[model samples]
Target: EEWMALRIGPVVNLPINHLAELSSKLDPDFPVVAVCNSAYRSSLAVGILQRQGFQNVASLAGGSQAWIDAGLPVYGTETQATVSAAPQRHVHLAERISAADLSRLMQDLPGTFDLVDIRPPQAFAEYALPGSRNAEIADLLSNPGYLTGAGPLVIVDRDGSLAMMIAGILSQKTQRPIKALQGGLD
Candidate 1:
């Protein structure tokens, strides 16, 4: 029999991919302790948070596994509802559209599809392709019904990772044709 992984304690679980939303959700000076099964992603998260102007941030030296190994307090039960707060990895393969193809499609068939840009509002305001609409990942995931459009929905991001993950999740949840921009807008 396999056992589910347990959380260390009551911690604000945030996915590293959605760090863009952190600024809006957390104060820049809020103390943050990033943790994971291993310390690799935690360290990365700490660096990203620091770059985003987060004043006090740190990563667990060896992560939750280490904490468990040290016999630290933990709380969870099989009956406890599993939290789906963290973004799931792209299990379903999402279709990718090359930039050239996307450009051609935009020019050749206007209104045929919706280009949803999932980048931060500031970045989108700074620069975005024509005919693209800004959207939050949370909205896209929660209210997928709004995705109804003429054709396939194309997701765009700064580096395509989040877009790919979103596309995969959406593909599993909706009947709409989904695609992520290959290599992102970077």
Candidate 2:
């Protein structure tokens, strides 16, 4: 019963300017509210935009948690997950491709992709896909080596969701197109 209280706005992200742009669509002088899974990411968003000379951008104090804590209404649309309206600074993320397509890419397009397995090495070793190279998402983000190569960088995980989420981050981090394997190994 209490869970139905999530009536809020569409999930939006930023490099500040995009947030401003999205805000401008509403009203050029409208203030931008940046919030993340929590306050930290939102703080970074607001800070970056301000530093970049964007004015009137404010990070939602305490973010969604704060709103929820205050017992505000949340128009939770559980079906709408993942953000599509992000700036160019964000990694362009794709939903997913089938396991069959993945197999084809491996066999047909050799050297075209990296077939990055974002799971831990231990899980990867247990039952890795045909030609996947274990590049844990965290490590890949830090190393930058994983950012190399051409073609579509397909990210894999045990399920589709984690890979999808990581794909967004990886794409943003590398400024390249990265995809998640749909439905993972399941």
Local accuracy by lDDT, each model = 0.84, 0.71
List, residue by residue over 119-177, the lDDT tens digit for candidate 2.
87889889887777887666866777767666777888888888888777767766556
Model 2, C-alpha of 185: deviation from truth (Å)? 1.0
Q: Among all windows of ten consecutive residues in candidate 2, which has the lowest summed lDDT?
A: 1-10
lDDT of 1 at 25: 83
Per-candidate TM-scores read 0.50, 0.50
Which candidate number maximizes lDDT? Answer: 1
**Under the 3 Å rule for N, CA and C atoms, how many clashes does model 2 have?**
9
Per-residue error (Å), model 2, residue 28 = 28
Give candidates' CA RMSD values in order: 17.8, 13.2
Q: What lDDT does candidate 1 reach at residue 79?
A: 59
